[model samples]
Target: RFDMAGVGDSELVEGGLLYVERTRADVVASMDALSERVDSRRFLLMGLCTGAYNAFRAALIDDRVVGCILLDGYSYPSIRSQIEHYRKRVFQLKRWVDFTKRKLGIDTPSGSAVQGDLVVFENEVVSKERFAGELQSLIDRNVRLLLVYTGLGPLSFTYRRQLHDAFPKIALDDVATVHFYPAADHTFTLPGHRQRLLDDLDTWLADEFESETAARG
Candidate 1:
């Protein structure tokens, strides 16, 4: 539940892209703070959505970071895909706005993905400010932008397969990789699947802890 300097709990500056800093010292300092709080020589990291990317970056640097678990990791798409997706969204929003205007004689702004179900695309939804912040952090830290958009993308299955291959190598004695509840969206809350997701998460965590204990003996 710990956050880095420019994010949630730490909240450094109040301007554009707080996480976009070149200070490796700052990154490690944040890690040090979290590590001290937990009173542990080694720690497990878990991230959801953009948090996954940040966790990945931190794990790469700190050996004390013994393991990581990521859910619904988003791979950055090419500029072309970003532009296309943006244009498509704009067109769809315009169409919706026009229809609403015709029907109600007024236009409504879109709601944010954070506020409600993103698929529903409510008119009252506000812009997701987190995206710019998160993406900027990823870019600043040079976190490997996955092949393309994180969830169900062109390489979704491939990325999972690669991770599966890496599992044996990564889930070593003190070090481990645990992916809980496959396809559980970002928060591990998807319709008609919470039970299955919970089961998988429980199994993965149990196995990880068990394996870690056995390694100690």
Candidate 2:
């Protein structure tokens, strides 16, 4: 995958901003460039963080995108998600110790509480209703969707079931595959974590693409 404009080796415009629209445009441009060189029409968009968001959005609009692998992508927490997050934190001894220290004026509160309000992304947030609709559209088109979560932060995805729980109405099991690697950090800095990430990707790609090929034949 190529880097977005103003990032990595790509030339950055003086006042360029990587907003949603611009990011989508860049993805389209990249696809167009690829088309000129490759004979294949099918494409699978894969990315992490904002890149993942872009890939999802791109796949929704572009019929050529047969699949997408989203890593730490859009996560909208539900009321239950918020409750579950704090419920887990409540059991942590460090949390109690910190609370007691603050109560006794021995230490100041560091604002590290696991809360939903803290789960904000820099770009505009898509409504759950709209996301659900988009997700359905992709499923109807038979796009292979893979969502992978890492141990970046619990605020966005506190648990393995958070995605399914947030969109209870949507039948995600029928449309998407999800994996959670809570022990691995966001970037997968450690060698073992990186290997785990790669292994997961290899398996997903083989299974998804092989199934698609068999279906076409």
Candidate lDDT (C-alpha), each: 0.47, 0.80
Candidate 2, residues 27-93, lDDT tens digits: the string is 8888888888985688999988777889998998889998898888877777876897678787989
Top TM-score prediction, candidate number: 2
The CA lDDT at 124 in model 2 is 75
TM-score of each: 0.46, 0.82
Instruction: State the lDDT of candidate 1 residue by residue for 131-171, as single tens digits.
Output: 34533443344332221113432223223334324333222
The TM-score, computed over Cα atoms with residue i paired to residue i, of candidate 1 is: 0.46
- Candidate 1: 10-residue stretch with minimal lDDT: 146-155
Clashing pairs in 2: none
The alpha-carbon lDDT assigned to residue 143 of candidate 2 equals 91
lDDT of 1 at 70: 57
